[model samples]
Target: MKLSTVFYFTILFIFISSASYSQAILQKNISLDVNRQRLENVLEILSNKGDFYFSYNSSIVKKDSLVSFRASNKTVKEILTELFNNTYEFRESGNYIIIRKAPIRMTLVTQKGITEEKIYSVSGFVYDEQSGAAISEASIYEKKMLASALTNEDGFFKIKLKSSKTSTAELTVSKEFYEDTTIKIQPRFDQQLSITMMPVEIPENNTVIKPEDYLAPDSLQVPTDTTEQQLPVSNDSIKVQQTGVGRFLLSGKQKVQSLNLKNFFTTRPFQISLVPGVSTHGQLNSQVINNFSLNIFGGYTAGTNGFEIGGLFNIDQKDVKYFQAAGLFNSVGGEVKGFQVAGINNLVQDNVYGFQAAGINNFVTGKMHGFQAAGIYNHVSDSVKGFQVAGIGNFSKEKASGVQIAGVSNISNREMNGVQIAGVVNYAKKLKGLQIGLINIADTSAGYSIGLINIIIKGYHKLSFSANEVENVNAAFKTGNSKLYSILRAGVNLSDSNKVYSFGYGLGSELSLNKKKTLSINPELSCQYLYLGSWDYLNLLNRFDLNFNIKLGKYISLFGGPSYSVYVTDQDVAFGGYRFPVPPSHYNTTKFSHKVTEIQP
Candidate 1:
């Protein structure tokens, strides 16, 4: 077949698929069996059963909580109203349904010749371009107005605003991992727009494009391996039996093992009990460890090598390998080698080698080698070698490698060797990577710093004071170290009456003639503005100087050099007001006091 025919057939197939999806009617009854579960989960069940989709924010909707209810047969609208208790509002757009916060109640009084506030409702549905599935929790915001809304469980939104006479604004739709789209809205009246967004195509493996191949000429590009490998999102709990993800579970295993405290003796490879007190340790359970453990409420084991799950908390006295999950907290004394998920916090005294997720904090006193995400803070005393995300701050006392993303600050006391992104400040000593925040500081920077204030304490800085033939008592604040530096200088003719201001940038290098005597050479180019009332002119000077330093003490040095200067200025100083190598005949003994070759000594 021809390529044009293939393209036409593909378009037709997609259109038919989307049309059928939109035309799917909700005829099946929504059978509910919720048991105090989260509203988001309940909505998901309803959408799946009724052949629709739910769009909601993960932040606003909790999906992990258990719910309780049982209904054999019920309509979708009735079930949702009872589930939400009339708190959230719902809007329907074809097969999609939108959930939103209810607005304040208002009465409609439509009459002739009555100037009342005209309220207009903007409704729409956001969908995926390829799959045509509803994209839940997509941001729909006005570009020029302060009105915005998030699409509900079915990717539907209804934003009601007071109508204006010339109310035309730009509407922007954005979603995570998707390309953003924008449309103009002329909302003098009520309007509905169904927006389809294309997902962004990111290469799976690391791929890079050079800047010079994309940017303008006259600029050099230093290309590095910028394809950062992002770690996978940390799982909340360990998977069971390494099964395929996303399969619906009608019911899970519910087994209990509990015996009297006197029935057991030595440590067991696996222990299952109603609580930790009646485990294999019997009455002497304080020092016993287990390879695999499970507790209905909470557990206190000496150590764990395999998986362990608890309802409230899991306290391991020594070390914990493999997966360990708890409802409240998980604490380990020695080290954690695998994944650990907790509701409140995960604390390890020695080190953690795998992934860890916590509701509040993840603390490792020794070191951390893998991914970690916490609600408040992630603190590692020794070092961190992988990715870490924190709600508030990320602190590493020693060296840190890989990526760190924090809400407030990312601080490393010693060396840091990766990307650091934070809200306020990112500081490190001897940073060998990139730092992006409001303020970035490094003691010694061998990498890039991008922020408002990029302070490199040991990089390039100096101050020098010198005297030249044209200007006496010249003081310059030379920035950048001895190897390469720039200068901003000012001088005055204290011996005469010619006040001059010089400002310029310079490039220079410093080399060691020997270990005992350090010598430097500098080539400086400057523009000087000579002021003579309103009669002012400009001076451009190019000079190269070799400076030899003789150290007297740690804080003092003596330096001098031989200078070759080429002066160019639009001034009435030479013969015919413009001349190089001024005529010796034009010079009187008293008139030409400061000649061009006066520096020849």
Candidate 2:
């Protein structure tokens, strides 16, 4: 009796577990009542009450059609069957119920037994599963042999397949906006079949989330999918090639093929094309990633893995791996990993990892990790990690960590951590490096600037009044950091008999001598033109000084130092009302003076 009781309990437990595991969401009981509403709304109501979700294609079901139904304490399967008029099927996938059209039954028309010929033919007619209508332009292909054919207007297609050791071969039928269908058949026989295809379905909750949802309005963001993870060829994949240049270069048929064959891509060893739409691969060239591509005039392709050359221009919809060259221009919608050269321009919508050289310009919308050389302009929308050289100008919208050399100007909108060398102007929003140009501008700087005019918006600035041997009253303005500063100086002697005036430019460095910065040492060099009652003869004064600075008040300081001066003149007599400190020389002569400067407030 004990053994029998234990056996009975075990059996009961097994039965209950199996019942729970095998039960499907379709068998769930729910109550739904609608007088007249949209079919989509009705499905939503059912989903809410049933505590489940519905996944169906919008094309298969007329979402706007009026639907009226009543079901109380009925299974989901029964309700769906009655609601769709018994024309659809219900399936369970995870926690959601999938609604699809009922697949039409296929019948074998004719078949021939094994033949002597190695090549056998498979002829078929494709039909819609829901409406029982012929599906035209449906693609029928074999996987292993790469053999393919398309159905005509009458839905008739015939494809030849080579027989091998395998007894059965699989045939796949696909069309735009349709679910791919595959079937197995004996490879040795010539067969005729009737095939049916279903429409692809998307989850009702599938949505595309743009990057602006969490970013600033002026910031750039790429749109992404909010659904589950997917492979490279899913519907959620972005069409990066839908750009302004692509619209003008790529044909409409090529664009359509790119959209329809998102889940299909193959590799080819070589491809040749006279133009974009006219290629060796026909309209399917956009779906092929070739190892080698050559064009007589111009070409368009999905991508390049090795080498590609064109006579006029080259357009690639995807990434470039090794090398690409063109006569007029080269446009790539994806990342570039190798060398790219063009006669006119090189345009890359994504990042670049190698060198880009162009005759006219080089434009990259994403980050650049390599070098760029152009004749006119080089522009990077994001940051740069390498060098940029251009004849006219170079611009980086974000941070720049490398060197920028230009004939005209170099501008960085954000931080700069490297060097900028330009003939005219160099600008950085925040600088941590060095700048060499005629004019250098920075909002904030922790580095040095060597230019005729260095303007740091938030940097050091001070005006000082002092007296030197050359003139009685002197005034100077200094700007930049303690490490490096620029000075503009002018001095005038108020004596009515022998008035002297001077104007000059100089550079200085300040070093702190105490922890509190109360005492400091300053070294400066300046060259000035002295007006010693003469305008026809040259009167130049050059000086070097070592100053001791003592901070007195919050905005005041007392500074004095020893100076060395050299005076050169070529005037035999005074031309104006003033006379020279010493007798004027008939020939060029130098006079030296060494003295202590007078401290002034």
Best by lDDT: 2
- Report how far residue 484 has shifted in candidate 2, in Å: 1.5
In candidate 1, stretches whose alpha carbon ends up further than 4 angstroms from where it belongs are: 1-266, 273-280, 462-601
Q: How do the residues 1-601 of candidate 2 rate in per-residue lDDT, one tens digit apiece?
A: 9999999999999988766644657888888767666666667677766666677765566666677677889998888888886667877765667777777777754556676788888897999888789988777766556566778889898988787888677987877867888888887788898998876554552422222222222122223323343323355332445666677877655565565566777788989999986887766676678899998898878889999999998888778889999999988878899999999999888899999999999999999889999999999999998999999999999999999999999999999899999999999999899999888888999988877778889987889999866577989888877788888899897777768888988888889999988899999888777787757767776778889999998799999988766666666575465756432334333334222122221
- Highest TM-score model number: 2
What RMSD does model 2 have?
8.9
- Each candidate's number of clashing pairs is 15, 0
